[model samples]
Target chain A: MEIIKIENLSKSYSSLKRKNNVLALDNVSLSVERGKIFGLLGQNGAGKTTLVKILLGLTHPTEGRFSLFGDSTNNYKNKKRIGYLPENHRFPNFLTAYQVLYYLGLLSELNYDGLKRKIFEALELVGLKGVEKKKVKTFSKGMMQRLGIAQAIIHNPDLIFLDEPTDGIDPIGRKEIRDILVRLKNENKTIFLNSHILSEVELITDNVAILHQGKLIKQGSISDLTAIENEYRITTDSELDTFLSKSDFVNFQLKKLNGFTYVLSGTDEDGLNKFVDLLRLNGITIKELIKQKLSLEEIFISLIKDLDKVK
Target chain B: MRNIFIIILYTLRELFARKLFIAFGIISTLAIGIIWMILANGSVMINQFGNANPGYDEMEKIVLGFEVSAILFLSDLFILIAIFSCANLISSMLEKGTIDVFLSKPISRTQLLVGKYLGGVTFVFINMTYLVVGIFLVVSFYFNLWSFTVLLAIPVITFTFALLNIFLIISGLLTRGSALGMIVTYFYFIVLSPILAARDSISNFISSDILKQFLDFLYYLLPQVHDIVKTVFKQILLQNENVQYELLIYSTIFLIAGLAISFFIFEKKDL
Candidate 1:
């Protein structure tokens, strides 16, 4: 089921000193499916925050329509099922971690009867079990981030929006948060993750969308986005140097690497087969041949650099 | 309703955490203590004024005058303090990104703003009541003047504060900072309102009818805080039934319009 559906969403901010409205989100459209971790990848000023704000009703959309839980109105009822952990989020400094969760949980309309238990559960889930009594002012960045996550999930919301969830978190804490997010996904809850942390998103997200300059340039399953077309990495027991010296292989391009490893690029799958056959014909014993794919970080950097070039 | 209540509680907690609530409480207690000490020696103080044995009516009048003076002074002090303390009520939430959390909850922007506004009013009301009722009891016990009319100042002062707080809230929302709101509120309360209240007398010196009409417009357009306090003082001291209901109605309308404007701006504003 589509937990969130946004169509032609655009937002522009007006300023007294500027001649033109600053476009924050430009004709962006996307949907989040239930029981999946959907990652929204963007650089700074890419309107990632604006998109989240619009969904959470923190701001009005200048154009387009969006629905939450299949309701186009985006009323308060839909918010009951939605949870948001905004970047740089702050709770009242004087409030203890327990109090922060309790307050937000009450705002979420959770009854006081079992709220204490929920607070404890959420704290423990975020690895903040015993520190619930400590005031937020004394908490470190990681602890505050954990508390933020605890507050976001204290109501057991069906759809959670986490912006830069691992920001300011140590690697170990980041891994723990990833674990909690995966656990939530396993519970059939949809998670819409807005993050610049490509490696973190690469680890857990089922689907990813790349946004650049307020425009969604690419979006799809992670596998499809990262897979290199008609490319394979092959390792053989013998090098193909002698074969390369005599043959004019115009159908494919081959580059030899360290030892017997070679990167082969072809026009299609049939071309890959022909290359494999040609290598085998030359008595190059094939030890391994695997399809190649780019890391998410590499893909993100490449996409952003490509866009920058176009600009 | 529940969400608004929770936000109110949250706002109160913020005030308590900031120590402003405790500060207001302590100040009220000190005022009460001072008033008790003064009223306990009411007879001796009157004797020093050449009145050896004042009648009950004279004593009531003297005590009522003193009560009115003290309340007026204390209400001004409390309003100034309250304005400064609650100035950051909305702005801090925006600066720290807490308002986003509140807006994301199952509550409308109206509920969030109303809850915060009521929270500020409730803070000021609690302190005003403490000080006013304390003085009322002290005077009632010492002078035997059970004047129920004195209690009216509690709501009147609170109403004035509620109106000023609307300005603070509007400024806070506009700039996302407390300094400008605090300054504008203090300016309006201390300088602008008093000057505008004297428009009729000040108009005599002004030759231009347009300028005089502009002064009248400002007096009527803004909250008539000075006039309201004057009316309240007359009612408390003279037992006057000739109340200016129009002033209250106009101020109430301003309050409603201010709140509606805040909600409209906040709802559409990009956080």
Candidate 2:
């Protein structure tokens, strides 16, 4: 199901004295599906957070339309089924972790009587089980992030929006949060995650979208966005150096590590196969070969640079 | 109802856990202790308890007067602390990014703001209960006299402060900085509220009818919180029969209008 759909959305900020309008989101649009872990990527000030804020009704769009679960974005009731963990989110240091979740859960429409077990389960899921009563001020940054996630998922909404869920988290904590997200996804919950940690998003997102200057620059399955179609990384025994020096068959080595292996990328299968055949003709031992794609970070950087050129 | 109540609780929890609440607690205790010291002296206790010198008057009335004096004096101090405490309620929430968590919930923006406003008053309410009631009990015990009228000032002073709180919350939302919010609120409190309260007296001195008319207009329009505070305290003391209706009316107007505007702006704001 199309859980979220946005069309031609735009948001601009202006100050009366400035006399110039700052365009934050410019005619951007996208869709999210139910039960899919969708990742949103952008550099700072690219309107990634702005778009989320609009959908969450934290801000209104200047011009556009959006709907969630076939309901208008302005539908108040739809908010009950959604949860958000804002970027750099904070809770009062004075409250115990449990108090924070209990209050937020109540705000999410869960009764305290019914929410205790859920809060415990969530804290446990976030690796914060026994520390429920610890004051939030005493919690480290990573623990706070985990608690933030716990609050976001406390009510077990149909869709959850997590902004920088793993920010300031340790590697182990990041892995733990990833596991929690995976577990949520396995329960058929849709997750809309935004993060600067590309590797983390790359690991779990079903689909990825890149936003640049309030514009939707790229959106697709991670495989498709980062995929080098029909490209192959051929690992051979010590022939890359000579191949580069001799240069037969139009040289298509993406990278050559230690003069043996080459990440051979080509636009089409024909080009890839041609390079492979030439490597075999060189009589260099073919140790192994496998198809590969660019990392999400690589694709993200390239897409941003490409967008920069057009601007 | 549940959502708004929870948000209110959420806000109250934050304020209680903060250091300012603790600071207020210590200050209230110390102030009460000082008041106790003054009451321990028999002469000051009997003579200075009431506005008039202690006489063969009923102990209840004299004790009531003393308690009323303490309530009024502490209220002045409380207002300062309350303003400092509440000045950051909305401004800091938005700036520190905690407001987003609440905004994303199923609750309305107005609900959040009102909840926060009430939550701020909740802190004031709790502290006043401790500070005001404690002072009342001590004076009654020390002087061997009991009076219920002094207790009435609790709610009266609180609502009056709530009326003043409107300015603080509005300034918080518009300015988005704690110091700036407090400065603006204090400006309204110090300058505008006072000017509006003495509008008639000042008007009599003005030579021009136009300036006097402007003063009268400003007096009615601006939230004369000081007027509300003073009149309510006087009413509690039973010293004034001419109750100032503007205290209730103007305070209510300022609260509703300031709250309405703050909510409207916050709802449309991008957090």
Candidate 3:
């Protein structure tokens, strides 16, 4: 089921003397499915943040329409099911982590007992249980990001929009955040993760959308996009220089590495088998044959470059 | 109703947590102490003057004048405080992005704006109440004056008028800076209103009836801080027989106009 459907949405800003219009979202339309980790990847100024803000109703679109949970942006009931973590995620400096969640819970109209339980659970989930009483101003950047995530999920929202969830986090903290997102996915919650961190997105996201210059260039399951043709890297102790020189392998452009290793890429499995057999017949002992799968970052960069070339 | 309560609670929490209430308390205490000392010294000086003079009941008259002046001065000071305290309350929230988090909830913009306005007004009311009590205790204990209820009404009305006027003008506009907004408001209240009120006094030297009439019209166009101060002085100190019904009517008009202006501006504000 499509949880969010944005159709041809656009926005621009105006100023004196000149109407400088930023095509923040240029007729962009996309849908997020239910119970999936949907990654929204984009470079800076690619309208990722603008799209998130539009979905959250922080800014009205200049044109087009969007619906959340099958209801239009003006629908209040739809908003209750959606939670948001802004890019910077600044809370009132005076509020502690616990108070922030409790306040949000109250705003969401949670009952007293439910609010208390949710606040405690959320703080614990985000590793903020022991420091719940510390003012938000005293928190480090990573802690603030965690608290932002905790507040976004305090009410157990069905759909959460997280913008730059791990922007400034260290490697271990980023891993922890990825783990939390994975746990949320296991609970069957829909998450829209917006970030430029391709590796982190690749680790946790089930599906991905790449946005470029205020437009979505490519989007699909990670498996589908990163599924390259069968390529093998063979490292062998036996010398097959004569076999490689005598055969059509040279014409096929087989790459030689370190005098004993050979790398070949082909679309057909039979071609790979024949190549392996020829190496074996030539008295070459293969120590390891490893298949190279494309990483999401590589695919993302390639896709964006392809889009740029086309444009 | 539940949503309103939640908003109110959040606003109150924010206000107290920011130490505004404590700051207001300390400032109020200092102001009342200074005014009380000045009035007491003035009264003593007036009594000494009357003792040295012959055939003049200057002590009673000077005491009455001192009472009137003290109440007037306190009322004006309270109004100034109210304006300065709540002027940037909403604009600052918007600028800081705190308002966006609240807006992302199911709450409407109107509810958020009204909640914030009420919270600020409530803060002003509480501070005014404290000021009133302090003035009462100081005046009654130190001067042997017992006009408690009468003196309290001046601060209450002046504070309300101050908040209403500010809410009318500042609630919906996109002000460039808080200091600029504050300076404009202060100048309008202190300099503009007084200059407009003294049209007749200036007209005597210039000998121009048209300019005097124009100034009279201008005086009626804006809020008259002096009139409010004078009304409070008459009701509290002079024990005047007739209440200033016209001034009360004019204050009500200003209050309604302010509310209407605030509503119109807030409705059109982008967010």
**Per-prediction DockQ, in order?**
0.70, 0.56, 0.36
RMSD of 2: 4.7
List model 2 lDDT by residue over B27-55, tens digit each.
88998898898877856556554544545
TM-score of model 1 relative to the true fold? 0.93
User: Among the candidates, what TM-score does chain A have in each?
Assistant: 0.93, 0.87, 0.87
What TM-score do all the candidates reach, one by one?
A: 0.93, 0.85, 0.80
Which is the leading candidate under TM-score? Answer: 1
Give lDDT tens digits, candidate 3, residues A99-154: 88887888776788778888889888888889988999999998998898887888
Error of 2 at A129 (Å): 3.5
RMSD in order of candidates: 2.6, 4.7, 5.2
What is the C-alpha local distance difference test score of candidate 2? 0.81
Chain B TM, cand. 1: 0.94
Q: Model 1 scores what on Cα lDDT?
A: 0.88
Q: Candidate 1 residues A29-147, lDDT tens each? A: 99989999999999999999999999988888999999988899878778889899999998888999999999899989899999999999999999998998898899999998898
DockQ for model 2 equals 0.56
Candidate scoring better on lDDT of 1 and 3:
1
User: What are the runs in model 3 whose C-alpha is more than 4 Å off?
Assistant: A17-19, A229-293, A307-311, B1-19, B31-68, B138-155, B158-173, B196-226, B232-271
lDDT of each: 0.88, 0.81, 0.73
The lDDT of model 3 is 0.73
